[model samples]
Target: MSEIPVTPLLDTVDTPSDLRKLDQSQLRQLADELRAEMISAVGTTGGHLGSGLGVVELTTAIHYVFDTPRDRVIWDVGHQAYPHKILTGRRSRIRTLRQGGGLSGFTKRSESEYDPFGAAHSSTSISAALGFAVANKIAGKPGKAIAVIGDGAMSAGMAYEAMNNAEQAGNRLIVILNDNDMSIAPPVGGLSSYLARIVSSREFLSIRELARKLARKLPKALHSAARKTDSFARGMAMGGTLFEELGFYYVGPIDGHDLEHLIPVLENVRDAAEGPCLIHVVTTKGKGYGPAEESADKYHGVQKFDVITGAQAKAPPGPPSYTSVFAKALIAEGERDPTICAITAAMPGGTGVDSFGAAFPDRSFDVGIAEQHAVTFAAGLAAQGMRPFCAIYSTFLQRAYDQVVHDVAIQNLPVRFAIDRAGLVGADGATHAGSFDVTYLASLPNFVVMAAADEAELVNMVHTCAMHDSGPIAVRYPRGNGTGVALPEVPELLEIGKGRIVRQGKKVAILSLGTRLAEALKAADILDAKGLSTTVADLRFAKPLDVELIRKLLISHEVAVTVEEASIGGLGAHVLTMASDEGLIDGGLKLRTLRLPDVFQDHDKPELQYKEAGLDAESIVETVLKALRMNSVGVVEEVRA
Candidate 1:
């Protein structure tokens, strides 16, 4: 393997205190070095790229000015914290960016003292910062709390709520609105237009200054009228007048890229700030780099790539990804049915719906990081005799759980949920893993839950959700490529609450759920070679489980094993509930459950993580064999391979 490159300036700096020692000119150099290091690191590790590059100078300025560890600096969403991590004593281990046992891709409070409040989701920084500000006030501490949030994050309702509450509290707080004109996807909605008006009006600052000066110099008797006139004119010139009404002292829409403009404005805001303050800084996404500037969204989160050609490291040829399979199936179904429409919260490309959006522009909706709004919007469409598919990642869907239960489940709307990343995500750590959706969604009253055995089954699930108008239906799938199966020309909907036994044997029966069917098949093969015949059945639906088929297997086979990709309170737990309710345990049928452990799994290769969790084929076979041996079935000395 080639040796890693060295970073000199990055190596020398360990903390924000070390950054404070550098002069303004050296700080500029440090910003350049930081950007280069970020690009280089992401080129190897494949994570968020453009946002970090855009915020390089801003990050440097903040660390240089603020006394961090004393004055808390919170990053909203934290996808842009790569530069912050490199400068804060973590440069040496930067290569292991999102790997297991390595540095987190986002800010983690447990990782370092510099990260006071950790965040992986968006629009949370302002709320967290406000909490710190309130706590500091109660403790009588002389500390400043600043929240650096992107323009896109500011559109969320929670952010506005924090701003309103912070203004009412009358506490000293700073909010830096980084206007980059991009989220993971380009920002949508009315807030985006308001920000655009502020950026386009170049002469807003000079005009506001002249009006303020004129208003102050007026006669004492007519001062109130003069102040009102100034406020009206200022509102007309700069578009941030709405913020003033909310009780926040509104500052500039300044040039963020220019250090000369940013440094002095920030210094003034830090010194003169009393109540809540908002400093609007305009910056370009992927500011300095040519390639990233041209394709900001493509580079938002990436894999290892060649810097010169900007080509990502190629994976060995595999089957179509689970996302592509779903997209293709949805498009096929859309062609057949005109009433079907698709919606995504902020992830069109990530959810593989970009092609569908292009083909059916009028039918697709990109709702922009608002999962709750997306679900309710889908519910509205479903109420009007339209079939709506709301495709979102499992982790992000957690944000809208209440909406799903109230708007969709309670109403029994026929909104189709296409949940992506339904298992252990390889990187991005615990915050991004899709482990809890099964347990959480199953608890809701009127919902149908299903999981695909493979890529071909995922296609059928899409067709099933599109056709089923009985109630809300959800299909969960994993990340990465599929099993290279030949796809069917037409999708066929399977019977609901029914399961198929793939391999029938006499001794033991293995019932698997979702993507873990392949592991069960492998374990069956291992047991077969040992003269211990194993039956494998795919329990397609988790909510309304095939109770009849499970009872038949328990009666015919001596031992039964339940396997699932979720945690303890998931499919396996539901099976145990069924057995206890049906009084199947009194029949002398031995049962063992294999699932992801209760604790959170750290970042690692997906295969290695499964092995460690004892959910792999070898581990499953070992677990089942041990159970059989303990039940007085003679232990096999060796399985014939």
Candidate 2:
């Protein structure tokens, strides 16, 4: 085990109150200690590292300057909030992050009062902070709302929408644009810091306010010209012309790492009687750590690691991840079809669209953090006689539901949706879990939804989706590695809405969907030992139910169970609705549906999560036995080989 870094300055600070008690000169040391502690804690627990390290000084300055809990500070996306968490009385449990029954990796409202709003997804802090600021204004309160948003998150339209409506906050809303990536402005230096200080100072703001008052008396045309002149001059000095036009007093392009630069600048913005302020602070991701600074992704998300060597623990070699398989298959498909193009929304690497993009740069599109635009863009591409595959995580696809329904589904476009991370994500918890895609997408008209049981099935499904040009089609696959099945050399275009029986029996029938097929097979072995002949069927499509196969199995078998890895209103709900509509339940059918629970699940190991959700083999056997009215277990020494 690696030794934890010494954090004597951090040890004394229990919360932001303790941080505020320290002298201004002591803050630099505090920030260093905070950075070291964050790296050490993340080294043990393994969560987001780069973003948090980037914002160490910024986090300290904000908490020190603002009266937090009373003054709401919302960290956008919350990947950079680990340092914030440590400063807000969570340092002791920081090492337990992302573990089952431990601290959450992102900011959670339930965890502490410091976290006014919880966030895991990107591009939400500005809107949430606006809400907080408006509520305080309406109540005639003294609290300010500060939103610390990254430049990457700014690509989303929602951030601009919030900024456009920010004038109403009236000196209560502060937006700190953490410019870690995408250097939107010239390099920050002494001159830029001096300019930031000058613009944000109370005297300069008061003079500007007087000038604005004096200009109002002039002709409308001159008044408008005067306003543009002031904005344009500042825009030239600092790269914030767009922000100035959006009704914000823009002040920055300052060094985010320097406490001297950040503290007074934040204090100035906090005290200035402006309508709203946008502070552009520049910092490097993985600023302090050498390994992270030198790495390509800046050691963005890491596993439990050695602090001294900066070496992460690697999992034993196994089957390729579902994401990699999908990427390879998409690349293969793109090679065959010239019209086939791939699209992703700010998740090229996560969804494996980066590989596809590398193969065919002209045909690939990585529209930043804009899921809605990505879907509509794919729809447009499909309409223009091009085959477009929108590769996105299932959880993120929820953001573009309106586009999916209005643009693709309504028009019946042949756009293919490659939904990745189709089920529970172990460390990211409920916010990232792809629990509702099947329910949402499968419910839409002119949409065909399919789930892959394994890597081979995923390959076949990708081929089917590529050939599917009648209407919108989607294929969902899980996050981690696939079951070690042989990949087919030639991809097969499977018959739509058809299911295959992996094993045949008479007494018990298990209808499985997605990755739960393995559990179903395992349950079959257990049932067979109990002298109950069991059957397992992998029903690939969720929207177009395998009517003939499902009906045949239901009528023939005494006990039938539908198993899927989705939430309520997914495959299980659809199956029940079908049985009810077809009068298949009139004969007192002993049918059961197994799926994710109604409530949100917490972060845990994948196997434990499945076990807790009652989607494991033992749970399947128990559900089957309960349905069969078998109260007592009958153990048999001799089992079928």
Candidate 3:
């Protein structure tokens, strides 16, 4: 085991109450200890490191200044709440962060009383804090709601909507804008810090308000002049005047790293009787660690690493990842076609669109954190006869369903949807898992939904969607590496709404979808060894349902089973509905469906998560035996074979 970091001050603090017991002068040392502790814990556990490191001092200051548990502190996105976790009595288990039976990567309301609200998605903190504030006001409670939102999250419209409505809880709702975004980082050059001080000062706000009121009372002709003068002056004075106009008493552009600055400002904000205050505290994404600070991304997320050398431990190299395959495939198609372009929602790198961007910078569009706009923008591009592939993680794509339905599907635009992370993503937990995309997308008319069983299939799907001009088509692939299948030099475009039988049999057949084909094949082997002839078919298109192939299998095989990586309403449901409608299953053939369990499975190793979800080979074999009522064979023993 590695050497655990020494933190004398941090060791004394079990909770925020323990932190508040110390003098204000001791906070700097405490913050140093806290940051060190967080680094060490993340070094061992390997989760979100940079975001939490950026907020160490801010976390310390907030916990020390405010009475938490009583006063709700909701962390936006919750990846940056590790320091808060360390301070809030969960320090003992901090080393187990993001492990199967340990602490979650993000905030969970069940984890501790300190976490008043749970969050994994972005831009939800402000709205949740507003809800808490309004509830407290109605109940006449003494609690105050504080929302710590990041600058990148500010790009989403939901945050602004919450801010606009926060005027009702004057002084009760506090928004701390953690400005770590390189785009929105503090203004560069010419005494920016000094200007921030001047703007945050009482005099500047008073003068700005006086000017606004005077302009309102002035003649319409002169009102425009006054407004322009005020805008120019305020823009020159403070960068946060835009937030002020949106119904927040804006403060700061303050230094987030300095405990001296953060502590005092936080204390004042807590004591003030102001409603809906937004404090813009500028912070570096990776504050203390040398390698993280030096890196372009600040090492936002990392695997387990060497703390001293900052060298991350690499996983054993295998096949090219599904994301890389998708990128390469997209780039190949883009090279062939001039009209092909790509759009991503804030995550150019995560969705592998950055590779495409590198090749086709003129055509690639990164629309920031706005998924809603990304969908509609792709629809517009497609409507104009351009083939626009909108690549987004499946979980994140849920935010733009309205746009997908109303803008893309309704209009039958040929916008291609590349949904990455389309299954149970480990470590990040259920919030990040892409479980419902097939269910939701397959139901939409004029929308073609497909899930890839391997990297080769993913390439075929990509090529197929690129050529597809009939309607909006989506291809969802899992989070990790491919299944080591040999890649085609140029992918063969698959016929839309078609499936292929991988193995042939007579007694029973397994219809597989997504990446579950491998497990089905394994199960087939076990079934063959048990003297039960088994057939397996990979159903590529979830929406179209390859009805002809399904009907033939249902008639030939005495038992039929459907397998998928999604929820109940996905591939299995579609197959069952199609089979029933066609009267293919009325001949008393046994039918079973394998899917993720009804409950939300917690974070674990991917293999273990699959086993728990009953989607593994053993589970499939067991399901087959149970459905067949094969009492003659030792089902459990046959699976062991």
Candidate 4:
């Protein structure tokens, strides 16, 4: 383990209640100590570093100023809530971040009461906080709901939608916009700090309330003009016209790192008898740590590292990540065709659209944290002569399901959906897992769904998607580096709805989809060693099942198993449905489907997750053996080597 940082003040505080016991003057030391402890903890555990570091003082201030648990505080996208977690009595498990049976990478309600509303996806805090505040109000409870949301999260429409309906929450709802990336206003300084403090003060709000009452007694025209003037003055001084329009009493552009500035303003907002308020707090992404401050993205998500040198552990050199291969393949396709374009929902780097954007700036679009818009935009592009590839994570693509169904699938538009993270993502846990894309996309009409078994297959699929113009098509691939297979120099445009047989055998047939093909091959080898000739088929397309091939395999093989790195309703379900439709199950053929379990899987190593899901080689072999034992055909007599 790395040397743990000394945090004298932080050691005294087991929870936010203990934190509130200290004198106001001692908070600076507490904040400093808290920041150091967080850095140390994240250094050991290797989770989200930059985001959590950015909100140290803000976390401290919110806990100090507000009565938490009673006054619920929800952190948007919760990746930045590590410091919040530390303050809220999870410090002991802080080092176990993102590990199996450990602290989750994001906020989880089951983890603590401090996390009133759990979140992993962006732009959901405001809406959730509004729900809490409204529920409390209905119950006649004395509590506030504070939402600390990043400015980047504000790019999504859901945040604004919640803000628009926040008037009913009254003084119970508070939104602190943590502006780390987008500088929506001038830099925070003495003037901005003074303005934030003054505007959020009780006296100022009282005076404004009196003026509003006075204006109500005036003529309709005068009252309207008075309201406009008040809005204009605030808009000019603080640049909160947009938020003001959304029915929030906007405050700040305050320095989030400054404990003194944040505490008083937050206290004022807490006590203010107004409708829902929006406070814009500006802070650096990597606020305090030297290494993180210097290179934000590198330290954003890291591996266990040397704390002193800020050197992260590096994985051994291996094959390129599936994301990179897809990017390169997309770029190659773009070079061949001018109409080919790309779109991503604020995850350019994660989805490999960053490389595409760099290669063809005009043809690529980073549509912010708006997956719905990205899908529809791609649909629009496809409706025209241009072919648009909407590259999004499987988890996030859920946000645009309505658009996928209504706009793309229904219209039969030729939008290519490059779905990344299509299976269990180890550290990110259940919320970030891509376990349902195959099921969801395959179920849609006018949609062709495919999954890549390896890097070369991914290249071919990308080429296939590029050339495909029949309707909405998607290719799903898992996270992390590919299986070290040599990538094709020239990508092949695979035939739609077709699968290839990898090995030929007689008794047992393994139907594999996505990255589970390697495990299927291993299972086949194990079965072959046991004198059971096993056939391994990489059924690339989850939808449009290769009827002839599947029927032939089922009729020829005594036992057939379908495996996928997805949920129960995906490839397995589809294969079962096809078998039933074709009356292939009546011939005394034993069949089984291996997929992710019905329950939501927790954060763990991908291999362990797959094993637990019974999608690993050993699990596959066990499943096949179990199936054979249950068979009445006496296959045990033919098992001799």
The lDDT for every candidate, in the order shown, is 0.82, 0.92, 0.87, 0.92
Q: Write the per-residue lDDT of candidate 1 for residues 258-335, one digit (tens) a residue.
A: 665566656655665256777766667777777788898887887788776777777898899999999999998899
Q: Please provide, for model 4 over 1-641, each residue's C-alpha lDDT reduced to its tens digit, 9 standing for 90 to 100.
A: 47788888899999999999999999999989988898888888898889989999999999998998899999999879999999988999998999999999999999999998889999999999999999999999999999999938989999999999999999999999999885586677988998999999999999999999999999999999999999999999998999999899999889999888889999999999999999999999888888988988788888987878899998999999999999999999999999999999989999899999999999999999999999999998988889999999999999999999999999999999999999999999999999889888999999999999999999999999999999999999999999999999988888888999999999999999989999999988888888789999999998888888898999999899999988878888888888899888877779899989998999999999998888899888888888887332225535447
Ranking by TM-score: 2, 4, 3, 1
- TM-score of every candidate: 0.91, 0.98, 0.94, 0.98
Q: By how many angstroms RMSD does model 1 differ from the true structure?
A: 5.1
lDDT of 4: 0.92
Q: What is the lDDT of residue 467 in candidate 4?
A: 93
Best model number under lDDT: 2
lDDT string for model 3 (169-198, tens) is 877889999988656654443355455555
TM-score of structure candidate 1: 0.91
In model 1, residue pairs whose N, Cα or C atoms come closer than 3 Å (at least 3 residues apart or on different chains), thus clashing, are 46-302, 46-303, 100-603
RMSD score of candidate 3 (Å): 3.3
Question: Model 2, residue 556: displacement in angstroms?
Answer: 0.3
Poorest lDDT segment (10 consecutive residues) of candidate 3: 632-641
